[model samples]
Target chain A: MTYCVGMVLDRGIVLMSDTRTNSGVDNISVFRKMFHWAVPGERIISVMTAGNLATTQSVISRLEERSKTPEERSNSLLELPTMFQVAVETGKLLRETVQDTQSENGEQGKGRFTASMIVAGQIKGMEPRLFMIYPEGNFIEASFDTPFFQIGETKYGRPILIRGYDRNMSFEDAVKLLMVSFDSTLKANLSVGLPLDMMVIERDKYEPAHEQRIEATDEYFLSVSSGWSDALRTAFHSLPNFSFGQPGNG
Target chain B: MTYCVGMVLDRGIVLMSDTRTNSGVDNISVFRKMFHWAVPGERIISVMTAGNLATTQSVISRLEERSKTPEERSNSLLELPTMFQVAVETGKLLRETVQDTQSENGEQGKGRFTASMIVAGQIKGMEPRLFMIYPEGNFIEASFDTPFFQIGETKYGRPILIRGYDRNMSFEDAVKLLMVSFDSTLKANLSVGLPLDMMVIERDKYEPAHEQRIEATDEYFLSVSSGWSDALRTAFHSLPNFSFGQPGNG
Candidate 1:
């Protein structure tokens, strides 16, 4: 299991993904699920994956190879004409990778080899875009009406995002918001763990504005986590208590 | 789909359940998920149901009838000497109800007609107790280490309970805490919704200290729902923002 989120704010885009992977509770390991490719000022793209590790790793590796050696292949993620095209290419790779792996195991591969991804990036002169790509090679774009995307272990972290997200919030606050969101999932679920990868893209910059890997001991993260819990306790206490007010008929 | 929570607090027990039930999105209706039978000054027991409506309804009806007509019923729920025995009786009824339905449906009843319950109550000369009864008829008691149990569409509302639960909190505060938790689930899940039913059993009272059905327009509930959104936003902003602090290597 994994937890990843991508948000398209007015200032730009912010993306975060946990690094944990496990076959079973007894066998767990950390694996980076965030991947990105950039052409400096020309374009910048990021992909965060969830689901089967083999399928996601294969899709990302093929994408890297195609981008780095464009001449040897007809397809190149970096050479895609737009963020939408990038999503299409990435979705194609994810679907094919999953299909290839599933076909190998015959009847036993029903729901095992599936994977999904969040694609975020910008092209020169184009506004930032974010998408959630499905294992079936289909995707949806983030819009003003729905400015964020989250996948994997999303429920425990969602209420915070639904309540805290603001279109005009700064990149720093957005990251803060994601941190709280991730922290909620981290506390509730064992499948998502620390050493989270994050990237910030400023609108029209065509390059990452900020990037960091938040580890277990990151000072700011630790503070946000413990502080958020305390703040929640305070907020809960501040709420007006319910009055029995003449019990209703049962 | 449903959401029901039972908390074991020092003061007593607080139980809340949504009234929404649906076969499909279009086929939805209100069905009470909470049922209680109390013998004044002796004992109080509340049951909150989730899962197949038919199964839960049947179980509740059988329990209610047996409790009311003990002369003809050998296993009256009211005749149970201990809260543990009450849970055992309820679990037995629930398992039989589900199995009866499934057997009638033949092989097509693989995962259907299943249900779970939260049994909470107090008996004279004994402390308050809480139990989560599974569809398989197995049950576990809530203790200091695990003070609460939530069933159905539970994830969206869990973090709040996890962070805010206190054994020594007042009954009013406990209800307030449950309101917030239920509100979160109501907001995030369509299948777990409005007109929540709640009961507070103060220790040794052997009767509900209070009982109410929280409607959508119930002034206090409305206040809590909207107030929670505001408080969460404020809390999110109160946390310090993140600093990228020199980009990390990819």
Candidate 2:
């Protein structure tokens, strides 16, 4: 399992993903799940994947392969006109890769080769965009009403996002919001672990604005984790208690 | 789908459940999911159900039927000597009810007739206990390490419980913790909805210490919901910001 979130904000786009992967509890391993391509001042594309490791790797490899081939250069991330086009091409590649792998593995691999992804970035002139690509290669773009998209182990962290998200918030606040969301998921689920990969693409810059690999022992993350817990406890205690009715009155 | 949680604390137990029941998004209805049987100072047992509605209802019906029948008195909740026995009998009844339903419904019902339950309360002389009963007639008691059990649509609300729960907290605190959990779940899920049923069973007293039906317009719940969002936003703003590395330094 994995947890990746992509947010489209007024100022920019933010992408974050956990590094943990596992076939089973005993076979846990850390793998980077965020991939990015930036042609300075032209375009920037970030892809965060969840679900089957092999299928995602195959899709990424195919995309990289196509980018290097002269004939396929026109369809590559560097040559794509907009983030929407990049998302469409990525979705197609993802679907084909899954189909190929499932065919090779036969009937038993019907659902085993499936994977999903969050693709977010900006083109030189177009607005930054965020999309959640489904296992079947279909996708949905984030809108004002739903400014963020999350894949894999999403429920634990979603409530925080729903309550805290604001389109007009600063990039710093956006990152902080996602940090809390990710921190909540990390605490509630073992499948999602650190270190985390975060990328901020400031709108119109067409280049990565900020990027970091947040390790488990990162001082900032530790502060946020402990701080959030303490804050919650404080907030909980501050809430008005339920006044009991008379005994036997239910 | 449903969301129900039960916690065993030093002061007593707190149980909460949402009233929404749905066959699909278009077919939703309100149904009470929390049931209790108390012999005043003698004993008090609260049962919270989740999963297949029919199976849960059948299990509760069977338990109620046995309690009212003279011949079946020996196996009824009223006659159970310990909360542990009550949990075991409830588990057995749940399993039998599910099996009976599935057999009648045929092969299509194989996975449909499953349900889970949280059985909590105290007997005359035993310590107040909490158990999560599975569909297979097996159950596990909550320990200090795992002081609460939640069934159905549980993930969204779990992070708060992980952060806020304290075994020695006051009964009021316990209810507040659960209200936060339920509020989070309600915000994130369409399957779980308003008009929550809450019960507090204080230690030794056996009878319910407090009970309430929290409507959508309930002032306390409204305050908690809005206050939580405000607190979270304030906490987020107080966190340290992510210091960006040099451009291109990932």
Candidate 3:
């Protein structure tokens, strides 16, 4: 399992994904799940994938190859006219990748070779957009009702995002929010681990305004991890003790 | 879907379960998920279930009836020799219930007619025991390293339990901690919801020392719910913002 999140803020898009992948608990591996393409000052697109590694990698490879040789596929990420088109192309590749793998593996593996992705970024004049692409090639763009998209082991980290996300928050705060969300997931689940990949695409920049890979030893991340735990404990203690009509109760 | 947690603390055992049960997002109903029986000074057993309502209800009804009249089906919970035996009996009953339902529904229903449960309580001389019963009739008891069990929609509430649980904490604190955990689950998942059922069985007592059903308007629960949102927001702000070597940041 994987955990990746992409948020559309007033400033830009902030995306974060863990690098852990595993066939089973014992056979763990680290693989980058975040991919990006930017034509300086023209358009920027970022994709974070979760699901069968083979399917995601094949889709990414196809995306990369098609962009370099647009005449072959024509749906090149670099040539996409808008973020919507980019999402459509990415979703199409993901669906084709899953179907191709499944057809080889036969009936039992039909749904096994599938993936989900979060696509985010902007074109020079268009507003930043965020979308969650499904294994079936369909997608939903984030809006005021849902300003963020998360794929993979999303539940463990969602309550924090539901509570902390603010459209007007700064990019730094957005990244910080994602950190806490990811940290909650990491601490609760074994599949999502450290060495997180993060990208901040400032509105209209067409390039990563700030990018960093947070490792287990990253000081700021460590503080956020340990500090959030402490803060939670403090917060837990601050809640009024439950009173079931006990003698010391209200 | 459901969210029910059973925890073992030094002073006693605490169990909490949401009352929401849904066949789909639009078809939701309230149903009690917590059941307990007390022999006053002999033994006290509590069961919290998550899964097919038919299977769980069947298992509980059989347990209840068999205990009242032990001649028909012999592994009656009340007549069990120890807490372990009670758990074994419950597991056997659960497995039989699932198998019976599945056989009637045929092949496509193989895994659907299943349920998981947390069984907790104590017998007069033995220590309190907690077991998580699976649909397969196999079960595992909670131990020092794993002092709690949560079934159905468990992920969202697990981190708080992992961080805040202490075997030595008071029943009030334990209930408080569970309220926060349930609150998190309720906020994140619609299937696990309001009007929580909670019961605490103190050491050596065969009856519930405290039992309460917290409704949507319960003041203490309201405070815990809204207060936790504020507390979490505060905690999120308290954590250090990410520093990607920004000149004014690091």
Q: Which 10 residues in a row give candidate 3 chain A its minimum summed lDDT?
A: A66-75
Please, what is the TM-score per model? 0.94, 0.94, 0.95
TM-score, candidate 1, is 0.94
| lDDT of each residue in A179-210, candidate 2, tens digit only | 89999998888989999998899988977888
Q: Positional deviation of A141 in candidate 2, in angstroms? A: 0.5
Q: Which is the better candidate, 1 or 2, if ranked by DockQ? A: 1
Tens digit of per-residue lDDT, candidate 1, span B163-189: 999899988888899999988888889
- Model 3, A1-250: lDDT tens digits are 8999999888888999999999999999999999898889898888899999988998988887844655666438888788888888988988888888889888887668889999988888899899999999999999998999889999889988988889999888888999989998998889999889989999889998877888788878888889988999988988887767844232
Q: What lDDT tens digits, residue by residue, belong to model 2 across residues B1-250?
A: 8999999888888999999999999999999999999998799999999988988988888887844666655437988778888988999999898888888889887877799999999998889999999999899999989999999999999999999999898877787788899999998889999999999899899898888898898777788898898877776676777656633323
Expressed as tens digits, the lDDT of each residue in B66-88 for candidate 3 is: 44655666436778889898888
- Report the CA-based lDDT of candidate 1 relative to the real structure: 0.89
> What's model 3's overall lDDT?
0.89
- In angstroms, how far off is B142's CA in candidate 1? 0.5
Fnat for model 1 comes to 0.70
Q: Which stretches of candidate 1 lie over 4 Å from their true place?
A: A66-75, A246-250, B65-75, B246-250
